[model samples]
Target: MSIIIITGGSRGIGASAAKQCAAKGMGIILTYNSHPAGAESVVRQINAVGGKAVALALDVTKVRSFAAFRDDVAKALKSTWGKDHIDGLVNNAGYGNFNAIEAVSEAEFDGLLNVHLKGPFFLTQALLPLMAAGGHIINMTSATTRVATPGAAPYAAFKGGLEVLTRYMAKEFGPRKIRANAISPGAIRTDMTSKAFDQSPEFVTLLAGQTALGKIGEADDVGRVIASLLSEDNGWVNAQTIEVGGGYNI
Candidate 1:
């Protein structure tokens, strides 16, 4: 079976992608930050359903820890899947914050950059050696890069950078037959956006109306797309940023 690693697999889009990938008969190595219990719960669910899965702790912002994390992944691969290479890597761990460019502090900006941009860049570099030929890399970006949303300036800016990086990865990794793509979700109902959905029904309604589907998306909507991208069926689709937003804002 093909083995895959997904960062931030404890909750939100990452968690959903983990489960969906497992359902596709792939062995899973999922990472969590700050929530071991949630990671364990996901592993338990996957095991209960007869799928193989393992969860490890990862603080994406801590670049110093990546070597240790890679060692742990090496161990997990050998012990669990009896393999030396991973077939897929999803850079999906991130948090959402809302602050306008003028109001955004340096600390806040650095925090987002560390997790969303720098973290993914270095982590992928650290793991690139273990990635098998024909492996796929899926970077979870945001549709905010395309749609100008108030108070999401830094987040969108970094995500836009990630989208550009995805193309570069595809170009550079093409010799190995590896592919890279970006998945951009629009106004999904996830833990990151739950507060907005809960505190302001009008905000949710406005977003829904902006979507051509007349509704917001669920985590699995994007998760399934990630799984499909990892599969051989999409082997020819590379260097693209797919918007899984149900056609938001026309």
Candidate 2:
């Protein structure tokens, strides 16, 4: 059985992707940071639907814990699926913080860096040995990296860094037949964007205007794309950053 690990699989795009991938008959090892109940609920839903899934707790910012996490993943694979290797890794765990560059404190910057870039980097490295040949890596980035958004300078910057890292990962890991790609999502109606949308109708209108598709995105909109990229049909697609926005700011 082909198994995949998805970080932050408890809610939003992560949860949607987990369900979609399971529907395609893939075994899932999903991780959550603060929402065990949410993660368990997702697992229950998947299993109830005749899919296989397991949820594990993980803090993406804690790079030091990656080795232990990898061990846990290996054990889960062995016990649950009778496998020692996984076919894909989705680095999707992240938090959004809005702050202008001048107002961004050192701690805020560090936190974003740790989760967005540093954690994914080391986590992939730690798990590489156990990743099967032809395995794929999907990094979750943001459309902010493409079109600059005010009050999100640091967050956008780090996401941009992850985009560059995606290409480098594809380059270095090519010999192993491992492909790396990034999914850059536009404004989605997840918890992350609820406040912004609720606070200002004008803001919502502005975002919708920027999108050629004439609306904000839903979590499933982006999730399905991520799942598709991980499938064998997209096996030749590599080192690309596919934007999942509704043609935002285009």
In terms of lDDT, the best-performing candidate is: 1
Model 2 per-residue lDDT tens digits across residues 1-250: 6799999999989999999999888999999999999999999999999999999989988888889999999899988999999999999999899888889999999999999999999999999999999999999999999898999898999999999999999999999999999999998888677877899989888899889999999999988998899999899999999999988998
- lDDT string for model 1 (32-55, tens) is 989899999999999999999999
TM-scores, in order shown?
Answer: 0.99, 0.98
Taken over the whole model, the C-alpha lDDT of each candidate is 0.94, 0.93
Clashing pairs in 2: none
Please list the residue runs of candidate 1 whose C-alpha ends up more than 4 Å from where it truly belongs after superposition: none
RMSD of each: 0.6, 0.8
**Backbone collision count in every prediction?**
0, 0
Candidate 1 overall lDDT versus native:
0.94
